[model samples]
Target: MTGIAGVLAWIEEHLGIDAAKGGLADAVLRHVKERCAELRVSPQSFLALVERDTTEQEGLVRVVSVGHTWFMRDREQLELVVGRFAGRGPGAPVRIWVAGCATGEEAYSIVLLADARGIPVRVLATDLNERSLSFGARARYGAWTVRGLTAPEREKLATPSGLFEIPERLKSLVTFQRHNLVDPPPRGATGFDAIVCRNVLLYFTKPRALDALRRMRSVLAPGGAIVTAASDVLADGTPSSDSELPRALAKSPTAPPTPVVADLTPPAPWGAEPAPPTKAADAAPVSDAAPREAPAEDGHGAVERARSALDRGDVDEARDLLKAALERDPLSIEGYVLHGIACDASGNTYAAMASFRSALVLDPSLWIAELYLGLGHDRLGAKGDARRCLARGLELHAKAPGLASLSSATQAMLAEGRAHLVEAAAAKLASL
Candidate 1:
């Protein structure tokens, strides 16, 4: 094998990471070069050391694996965990394992949520990287990690450092450990009440991923649930069997069931909308109103449902429902707008922009779409686009009727949008 190929093979065999399947081969090579430079060793020598030394192999895996995660990364799944155990009496401890916990944002988020809701729970957070576990133990994070938190939530749990430091109480609820999913369950990891393994399986080949899934399933307590990425669904578009968190574990060891996989894929924006049907040559064209009215009703219903899902912090469900709404009526302005909101909440800025742009295409009068589109652009660091869109939205809002005339939700959205716009402008000026 070529040198790079041989190294990649080693990574897969030892780390259970299929570099090519993970689309991270290039990144792994880059990390290898950086590591070699840091150690003052030749590439060949470094590779030899990694082969011979277990510690070096572990360090290499840590460097190659991306740990880009944040607090409340998937709010809906967190809510599910809370809802399940919050009301239970203290007879049995609510056990949760955050597999691939990556620096502890997800694990700590769970602990914080449980405390806020008065749930008595214990969290075991494990990852393959020892350095990441050490960082999690520190419980300090940059502001970007806590962006989704409300002011009250931030004040209650964090104190300001160069980066925010999580309160000791929250940190005390979780135990971080070094563990690998490709291996057997670590001691004391069995019978968890809930297991959260989001966004981790995509790193392996299908066979390896299945093996990891089976291992994860084996450790669950009877009726315990495992939550994963929504994209991990079955071919039929229904949530895979793994998503049934409340289902009782089967008696047979060989009958390993699937875990709940939450979908995080952004809904397709307006550009992918199907074209309208052509009119018959012999018949006069139908009035635009009749065709428009029917779809509008369907779209409105769907958007309303999406809004309800969002209210409950079920972002995946909201996005899925919005996708159906848009499919039913491509020109549904409200559907596109609501979909944009869901995408923004889920950290999908580009998709959010596309959804907002689609809404504007359907109705240029939608000031809300412009406002959200601007916020999305700002998050993506498109300063010029952000400024123009925000300016236009604000101008439109000023010309509209009194704020008392709008719905409470719309009022809230407008206020939040304005705040983001001002923040973006201030940031731009600070850089000058």
Candidate 2:
């Protein structure tokens, strides 16, 4: 009874997968058609199959995934971990989980690094895509995957066929498995010394990602850590829209001092994400205290400078500064809204709308972002989207108490930089 739009909504809600910007939306359509042909069913009937079978619905995760990976693509974290474990010399082989291991390059890279450091490690590599896992399990990689190895390192892994065949010794250290990270870690997969989920959480919605991180923390041995690509994190080492929102999410007694440690960059990390959770008021309010870097020189500083440039009517300067600031801190909600405004002032309505959407993706409660986004949509002649955004913004802004009663977990999310959202939303709606 549902079409493609409804199907996508289902996937986004259930699995927190946003196929829109990743070019996977079209792949969904293609996958549906292919499955229908394979099953000799109509599109409607295929939708029925997707609903009845969990496996059918889960297939979309694979559909959206690409397995283009080379060894040591992002190796700093791997090297760091090897050095740490090598020095500690845990009596037994250290256990590591490589989530979203595309075609085994990262997992194999970890093994080689640890081998070179004279430490033993057991890597449990996983991916939703079975094809990639199977390829990894084979322990044979093309020259590209081996290009990063030093001549001495390359000499150790000799193959008559010229492909880099992992030696049985190194191959023995890794185990490949099919897994869905959104679910709990597989059985026999507890108490890891470290978990390396590189650049993978960027594919997850914020809350969904946090949920996975919490799960990862549960299985980590005391003093163990979770490693992620540097670009994959937010201001405080998590991919939260509001810099302060995940403070509660980051807390745990048995976990390592820092649950998350980032590495490489996350790929174009803003478009769509989960909506805000039901607001809670029973918990005590948490004081704002995450990593507040250089009040005069960091993201906060850049945003203030951009504001000054805008007041001086220099839209270009403001936009450039805002862009740079956002590049450094994508979780800066103020920077995003201001960037949208600057874009609009520069007559780049589309970019303005995208910037506003990015803001909403982090914190939908931002009535200001919704109102401005609606305005952008209106300028683009998209009446339906304009009405939806405007109405939501106006409705949220109408709440009498207005974003003040945040729970201990999220009080820090919007506590700062208020006093303007309500005034602006109300003024815009009244004018309209």
Pick by TM-score: which candidate is best? Answer: 1
Tell how far residue 101 is off in model 2, in angstroms: 1.4
Looking at model 2, report the run of 10 residues with the lowest lDDT sum.
280-289
Q: CA lDDT, every prediction?
A: 0.61, 0.61
**What total of clashing residue pairs does each candidate reach?**
8, 7
Query: In model 2, which runs have C-alpha deviations exceeding 4 angstroms?
Result: 33-42, 53-59, 233-432
lDDT of 2 at 145: 46
**Model 2 reaches what TM-score against the true structure?**
0.53
Q: Considering every candidate listed, which one attains the maximal lDDT?
A: 1
TM-score of each: 0.56, 0.53
Question: Where is the poorest 10-residue window by lDDT in model 1?
Answer: 281-290
Candidate 2 local lDDT, 179-231, one digit each (tens): 66667665556667777876556555566677777767666665566776433
